[model samples]
Target: MPSTILRRAACLLVVLAVLAALQACSSGDSKTGAAVLNPSTLSSTIPVTRAACTPFGAAPSVVQAALDGALNPSCEPGGEKLERWADSDGTMRDACLFEPAAASTAHPLPLLIYLHPSLVGTDLSLDVTNIRSQLETADLSGDPDRPGFIMLAPYGRVGTRYYPLPDQDYSPGWDNWYRQMLPDGQERRVNGTTYAANVDAAAIDHYLQLVLAQGKVDRRRIYIMGWSNGSAMATLYALNRPQIAAAAVYSSPDPFGAFNDPCVQQPVVGKPKDDTELQLLNPQLPIYHMHNACDIAGLCPNSLQLRDSLASAGATLIDDHIIDASLKDVAQCNALCGTDPLANYAGLDAPGGYAANLPGYAIGTVNHLRWPSSRTVDLFDFLRDHPKP
Candidate 1:
């Protein structure tokens, strides 16, 4: 009887040992499985469809067709004119196109999309040609040896109406005209001004398609620039489209929100709380942001906030400048209420000021709107230096 009892005890001990060993193995497997399922380790497999290649050197037919498509006119093509392209929603909008003087060499020319200030009274037709000429004078294309490039200035809608009198009725802001939406659903101004539909993604895509069809533009060299609200839109485009090589924004506001928004956890495209679609779409693009110290339109703080957000997302801070002093030109200074001068660091400590902040960015300040001769020169130089990574 004693021997039988001992055998039973030994058998029970062996069974318990096997169960413990199995439990240990199971725990180890679970840990390994968890490690494999880490979010960072998961690869994004979405395939991107690249636009058709347009070589630097192409037949005249291809080039002409592209020019024709981009500059399709409602009336006979005469002097430099404002033309409209329909958006996905079938809304017509305005865009200005300048064909580079016929190049002697086949060097592919860069295409620059210049966005205008939303508060400007005139459209692209009024100042686009002059602006292009100024850019050329600045030698913005990097080298005279190269083919130079084409310039396209798209008009943005006004956000508000300027009342000659302060007590007069309100006017439409630029965003309202561009988006065709009310401000937080407000009413339109008496001016009845609207943005040309061509500035939107659909219209921009069509314009790109026309460029691709021409087979002369360098797809890798497309760029964007804008001022004020237009600058904000340019940043939005760069954020949403991977094809844009680089961007230069002047006096622009933050697209998503202020710099302190906690939702902007990182700069890697999709990590931000707002505009997830935009972040996911264009993860690897460069941005150049510029702002003044005393921007009356609230552009200074907005630009700084965006710079911080972009830095947090692992974006390369290419160039940054803050102009706070009064302009030397008495007339220009007076026009800008003496805000033309670039301010010192002390001048930026006021409410919604930008001073002592941006990391890994080039900051500067100068007189206001000196055109391609001054601020634009610096901006375009930065763009030429940094291409899409």
Candidate 2:
């Protein structure tokens, strides 16, 4: 048997080795055959050009004004389209509220939380007209057959990157907060941009808490949808929070290597070691994952992996459609997959085939990133069928 000091030294070596492996995977690069990011040079905010939000106008400002008008009905008392809620870290977040035009007095309506991609914050970051046009094309805003539902799209912090530090601390020159963990299992406040402990999850919880207090929401019928980074966050939130009945995520990556914590024994992809800080979420949350085969940001394979993970946890995999570049083929693909293909494959001409080899998941292809209106309808239908118990 080894002495106590030797045992401790061995444990330290094992921890260092595991951390080194994880660092390499997270950074997408490696040094001396080890993957890791330069911890000392970590910055909170990365510069990203704000997406254009022009709607029926040449200038961005004009489009923003139009979006404001659409979201905030002129007849409302406050004349405010959004209600703001603060998180634990004192960050004031806003959510756009869309009340149904003719809600029945007896039935409380379902709520759908829409999370935008990491380009610009708010619904107006992209061309307001373009976004609105897309929503209209999807039939999400004006659907006569669906239940009366309220839509809320919350704005995340305006930064290109997200940090997953152990706790929250403020640093000058960095707009976001970070948390640091000491060697003794104590959390310390470090000055700089650190990782948020599931900032998306915390933000949703904050929004839900505030909405519930208003007494207009049906607690069992909350649904979520997100794009890109927002999509990944949405999936994470649904997996961890039982209140969410269903979720839709598009073009997102895995969350395994992003954080600095150890893994928890839930239901993750690989057989992650016992010391990892990432937890395996075991809830049976319904999820709709959409991705394009040629997605430049997140590869289609990653989305398949996520779908497989969800299925392993007993969640229903409603449908997975892959988009290629051939229009004719895309139509055929949608017909075969029982979902639309042209919506996400906006530019491509549908040539690629479905990634059917992905384990424990369904796969399809489209030409681009915009999923069809039918896909959205299917997701909402799934949410309606699986109310929270």
Candidate 3:
């Protein structure tokens, strides 16, 4: 064959090779035929296996100390292992994880992150709420369809302030919100910009990422709950993370900075600038807010205002229930107390101790500390029904 003929044959082969390479590249695109060649698809399909958490031995003592308001407290819930992760600021943070035996990659459990209140840590919160028991019951129920949950209770950093109510208790608080008194005495609001710089928020985000990496979490059913100040944290977290399925809180303070003169008198709710601030909350997210009638911080009015505000913003679903705290009926304890009417109020200062017995403070503290009685509402049922759509 002539040289020209050989060269023409080589050119034809090179053109075919180029066309084949182009076809391969096109197929690699996520929008094209086979996702096998796509890097995104490959990464997504690969099963992630994180090492099982090591069990922390000193769980019981830590719990008791927290309940008694010990000067130094560390969070380690009973039977649950402590998980430590570094914050964005490189400070190590602690979390207690209660993973059900049924939790596996094949049967991932719904993840519920519990944020503790101002003064106490994870152990006390879990103890008082009895949420761990509830989860255990569900897991051991022998029902395949209703697998239990994996709870991750992350510890908030201890605050600098010395809280002096019902005797001095060490305060471990979240940076999600901070109250500031306005110029006109008695009015207070959460510092909008300052609270945004929350380091705990960053740490909580990292905590979530670590839990998800374990492969035993159902991402769609991720929920958060909090009590008192922690409830405020939950509100901010849900707002920041729209992917959250729902938020169920107890005695949340004014999250929107709308309430003024809290606890001093009847809190007055004022409108936020425009509706933009209020609309930041995902309208589709289900919120179950339970507040006691006579709360110490006067938070009931705040809950009512938030409910009305969300409604005006076209929120898809929000359940707000104000439990009647006036009646200390043992019947209303919902088995939280066994034959003793005051069992629900255990560990708290007795009725006449210090200033805690001041009128409403007697039973008011009990009502605030206790969860909404199951007779009034079922929080678990609400959580089970609402997954991220």
Task: Please name the candidate that would achieve the greatest TM-score relative to the true structure.
Answer: 3
What is each predicted model's overall lDDT from 0 to 1? 0.44, 0.43, 0.53
Q: lDDT of candidate 2 vs native?
A: 0.43
In what order do the candidates fall by lDDT, top score first? 3, 1, 2
Native-to-model Cα distance after best TM-score fit, residue 322 in candidate 2, in Å: 2.0
Question: TM per model?
Answer: 0.55, 0.52, 0.61
Which 10 consecutive positions of candidate 2 have the poorest summed lDDT? 53-62
- Worst 10 contiguous positions by lDDT, candidate 3: 53-62
Once fitted onto the true fold, the runs of candidate 3 whose alpha carbons sit more than 4 angstroms away are 1-83, 139-144, 160-170, 178-197, 258-281, 315-317, 326-362, 373-377
TM-score-wise, the better of 1 and 2 is 1
Q: Tell me the deviation in Å of residue 193 in model 2.
A: 19
**Whole-model lDDT for model 1 versus the true structure?**
0.44
- TM-score for candidate 1: 0.55
**Alpha-carbon lDDT of model 3:** 0.53
Residue pairs of candidate 3 with colliding backbone atoms: none
Task: Give model 2's clash tally.
Answer: 42
